[model samples]
Target: MIEHTVKAFDADIGQLRGLISQMGGLAEDAIAQAMLALQRVDRDHADRVRADDKAIDAIEAEVERLAVRIIALRAPMANDLREVVAALKIAGVVERIGDYAKNIAKRVPLIESEQRIEPVSTLPAMARMASEMVRDALDAFAARDADAAVRVCESDSALDDFYDSIFRTLVTYMVENPKTISQVAHLLFVAKNLERIGDHATNVAEMVYFAATGTQMAERERSARSL
Candidate 1:
């Protein structure tokens, strides 16, 4: 009976991890599709991303329900508890990432059929970095490697730098070409959303680190408790 119970417990945890992985993959796709939609000015692709948000929302609800049930019944300890807690943290980040996807989707209609600004370089780079961060963070969680998690978390710096550069460049565009301010402003929001997505991925990496090491490696995660 104890053996069966242990199997059941492991199964439940596996299910939760599976849900996290599913949501993470969806978020990655949403961001990638959103970027493609932007590059191609494809309204249909943007609509697809907006539609996928509902599915991501459903996954989050399921993840939370399972996590809560496991906590209530199994009362996992040590590594198990850390894993569940990390799963919960990741669920929230994945949902926020979906939200960013939706935000970018909203801009598709506004920008489609309009003339794009020159040097649309940094946004794509930022999206690629953010997407990779999400994937790497999930990988670190699955592997339970604190060092890998730390590396993933540290990667956000490049995304932030790219975001800031885009911001400055866009502001300059708006100032120089006052007539393009409206369009440039929309792109600014997209860049900001992508940057926020990176932040969420970093948060997941930190959670994974805590789960693996039981000690906070980043000041941002540690300072989070005081708040």
Candidate 2:
């Protein structure tokens, strides 16, 4: 009976991991597609990205239910309990990441600039880096890889750098072309959303590290930004 119970608990954990993986894939796709919509100025694509956020939210609710059930039934302790709790928190974080992508999508129609702005060209690369961090953080969680989680944390700094550069460029552009301030302001929000996504990814990585090692990751120094 003890052996059977152990197997059942293992199966439950496996199922939980599977759900997280599925949710992560959707979140990653949302970021990529939202950026594509921004780059192409496609309202249809942007609308689809916004609509897809519901799917991520649904999965998060499901994860919460499953996690609660596991705690009630399995009475998981130590590492197992940590893993389950981390999944719950990570689900919420990933859902927020999806929301950030949706926020970016919502801004597509607001930007009406016909001329290609310099800052607009740089946003996609920043979005890609943010998306990659999300992917890696999820991978770390799935593998229970502390080193991979640390790498994800390290990548956050680069994303911050990208945001800083984009912020500076947008401010300069707005100063030079006073007529484009409104449109450029929308791009600034989009950049901020991507930066927040990176921060969310780092949050997930920290959770994963704690779940894997049962110890909190040490804080790393970040460059000070005036903005």
What C-alpha lDDT values do all the predictions have? 0.88, 0.93
- Tell me how far the alpha carbon of residue 8 in candidate 1 is from the true structure, in angstroms, after superposition: 1.0
lDDT of 2 at 100: 94
| Structural RMSD, model 2 | 2.8
Q: Which digits, one per residue and each the tens of the lDDT, describe model 1 over residues 1-227?
A: 98987999999988998999899999999999998888777889899899989999999999999999999999899989999989987998899999998899889788643566774556788899999999999988888889988898778888899899899999998899887877788899999999998898888988998999888886665678889
lDDT of 2 by residue, 52-136 (tens): 9999999999999999999999999999999999999999999999999999999999985678776788999999999999999
What RMSD does each model have against the real structure? 2.1, 2.8
Give the Å shift of residue 49 in candidate 2: 0.5
Stretches of candidate 1 off by over 4 Å are 218-227
